[model samples]
Target: MDAIVLLRDGLAAALTPGNLLWAFCGVLLGTAVGVLPGMGSAMAVALLLPVTFQMDPTSAFILFAGVYYGGMFGGATTSILLNTPGQASSIATTYEGHRMALGGRAPQALGTAVIGSFVASIIGTLVVALFAPTMVDFALKFGPGEYFALTVFSFVAVAAVVSGSVLRGVASLLIGLAIGLVGIDGQSGAPRFDFGSPVLLDGIDIVIVTVGLLALGEVLHVAARGRNAPDLASIRAGKPWLKRRDVRRSLPAWLRGTALGTAFGPIPGSGAEIPTFLSLGAERRLAKRREQRGGGESEFGKGAIEGVAGPEAANNGSAAGSLVPLLGLGLPTSATAAIMLAAFQQYGLQPGPVLFERNGDLVWTLLASLLIGSVLLLVINLPFAPLWARLLKLPKPYLYAGITLFSVLAVYAINASVVHLVMLIGVALLAFVMRHFGVPVAPALIGVVLGPIAESELRRALAASAGDLSILVDSGISLTLYALVLIAAFIPLVSRVRRLRAERRERETTGAGTS
Candidate 1:
């Protein structure tokens, strides 16, 4: 009842004409930047931080909330249509989303992604509003050991589920780990693979890696295919609306993804990447089960609607989930949240238990603004999804040329360093070779993302326990995560063995009948 009263007051405050206009501007600006590779919500907020200094706190927060949600929505647009992810969180969507676009289901993919993001954003914000304190308590329980276990779980789940072959997946993951190890060691302050260059000491940026591997690599790969390359412009986009059948298929996936995102979002350092990939793995497994029962065909390797829906939902939900810790504990789980934290400090407001007591109205108003932002995002983006898909209709030469230009600009924009451009070319070549050999690039990307986190957490746990191995599993959270890892790894092996046995039995029966 108290919550209801506070929300009512918040809505009354947030629905003002000035606040509504700010929300619209924020979402509009956010979507524009998010559609560009390497430019995400964090950059958008960072750029606008100074402009907000003159604005009221409530209006400023409302604008930031709009940008945060809008970025999530825009990231999916490119990942589905162009095979380029606007940010790391959208990478999971690219695995199946691009394939769906190639199969001429671009409109459906975009539709599912938009609806799923909207659903997740609304639910995730409400979850934050109603359960922020409880979620903060839960997040505080994680130690280094638990964090290590969580990374391991993510590794095994993505490797086993995303790859067609386990060996290839492991190889790609190792390549990523090696790339992640290029900079100076954080613990020892010693260079590992700097190659005698000052630029190498700082390590390769994630933006460079993502753009090189997904965007530039794709351009090179297509160029290598010569005239025989598939013509994307020829692919006919069907109706611009999601059919009832598509919605029915996507609704369950959206809910499951939202649940996963909400559950993992509050954990510091977990980020949207883990939950988005986990959601993809879960949907893949469920599709396989449904196919085995003769209920439906699994379209995982092709472009399944569930794949786009689940991961996109998870990405937005995790974005919303990260706010729980940010508001209640004053902890930033992501880059954008970190900037927002600075914004809070600039306003002389400290977030914690006292925050709710001291500025209860402001907190509720912020949450209400998030809800309003979500509605604006859907209204602004849904009508134009089909128009976004029409981007593929451009001539291949122009399309590829545009991609190359953006790829170069994205890398050069990092620090205006020529060495990064050289590294981008190198990474693109590596990606091209991997693609030629049918090696999955997703695992490598995951490794680059989670490898350092895993290593840091493992070392922290060991250092804390004075080199005691038992300390890693001493906590219930760590133990449970390891158990989940075992189950995830074991299930695939069991299925492979059962299938081999069935094949052998069938062969022997055929031989006996022939005799």
Candidate 2:
């Protein structure tokens, strides 16, 4: 009942004309960025962060929520129409989605993707609203040791599980940690990496780092690709309208994908990509089983509406699900969520249990705004998906130039500092190098956001226990988190070993045949 009352109040606040306008603008901008290859919600939000510095926090968050959900909706458009996934999470959608488009069922594939995204977003946001408080209640029990353990788990999971190469992921994370260490030591007010520069003492601003790494770095990387960039000249998106039979086939898949996404979303390091792939695999298996049972013919390789529906739903659901941890535990599970965390810090707000107590209305209002964003996403994206795809029609050089302009302006906007601009260039160069080396940047961003927090908690824990190392695992909660960390770290190595062995066996079999 209390939750209901709060939601109602939030609805009232979110319904304000100003907030609604921001939501509309955010979704529009988010969809545009998502339609463009290599640009995601994280980059959009990071670029916009400086613009929102003076705006009301509530309104800024509403805009961000809209952009976050809108990116999910827009990613499927390119995947279905062009076989090019705008975001990593949309990679699963491309398998059946492009095939569907090739089979002249592009409209049905797109329709299912949009509607499935809608269904998943609505259900997923509701789950967050209902369960976020409970998560906060659970988080209230966390001491410094437990928090440190949680950070450790996040670090290992992101560095080990998210990256294809664990070594590269760890390297990226160390780079971020090193960047985070540039400021003064919070514990003793001692400078660590200032190098006798006044600007260095203030530390690298999150805004500069995000804009440089995401927006500017992406531009540089894309520019380096030059003529090799993915061509969008052959893109075609017809009207996306589903037949009754298509709807019937997609509904169940939508539900199933939503369930999987919601289940895995809150787990740190498990991004939308995991749930989306799982949904794809599940849909593939279900179709096979249905065929075997004489229920229907399986469309495993061909364009299946179920395939597009399930993965798209899972993508959006997981996107929404990531918010649960971000809102309740102050943990960011995805790149966008990590940037959102930086936004929270910019507003002098922390997104944990204390947030609900101190700014309960803002929290509820943000949740309500997310609901509004989801609905707006459906309304705007359903009919305009093709138009969004045409965003690729814009010349690449011009698009990159604009991004470069914004990157510089966004950094310059931060207290109008030239030193920050230099730092942005350095970070952008670093980001390009990381991208060139195939290192995952998300883990690095996560390390930048969480490294200081983890250090502070660990230091506090040690201080409390008089430098005893065992204090880090004294509590059941802390021990459980560390245990999960070990499991998370170990699983990747095991998988790698299996993969290598399978490759070796394949080589031997191929050699025998050749001989």
Best by TM-score: 1
Worst 10 residues of 2 by lDDT: 229-238
Best by lDDT: 1
lDDT of 1 by residue, 316-435 (tens): 999899988888889998889999999998888997778888998889998898888888988888887778888889998898898788778978988899999999999999999998
Model 1, poorest ten-residue lDDT window? 231-240
Predictions in order: lDDT: 0.88, 0.80
Task: Estimate candidate 1's alpha-carbon lDDT, on a 0 to 1 scale.
Answer: 0.88
- Per-residue C-alpha lDDT of model 2 across residues 1-515, encoded as one tens digit per residue: 68778888998999999999999999889887786555668778998999999999999999998888888877777677655556667767877887877666666677788889889988988887787766445545677888788777767766764466889979988988888898899999999899999889989987677666666777788779888855544445567778788888999999999998876677665578667766776787688679879998998678888889998999988887888888788998788999999999999999987888898898899888888888888898778756654555577777567657755775787689888889988998998998898986766766777788789988999999999999888889888878877887787687679879999999999999999
Show how many residue pairs clash in every candidate, following the order shown: 0, 0
Q: Model 1 residue 33 lDDT?
A: 76
lDDT of model 2 at position 60:
97
- For model 2, the local distance difference test gives 0.80
Q: Which residue pairs collide, candidate 2?
A: none
Cα-based lDDT at residue 12, candidate 1: 92
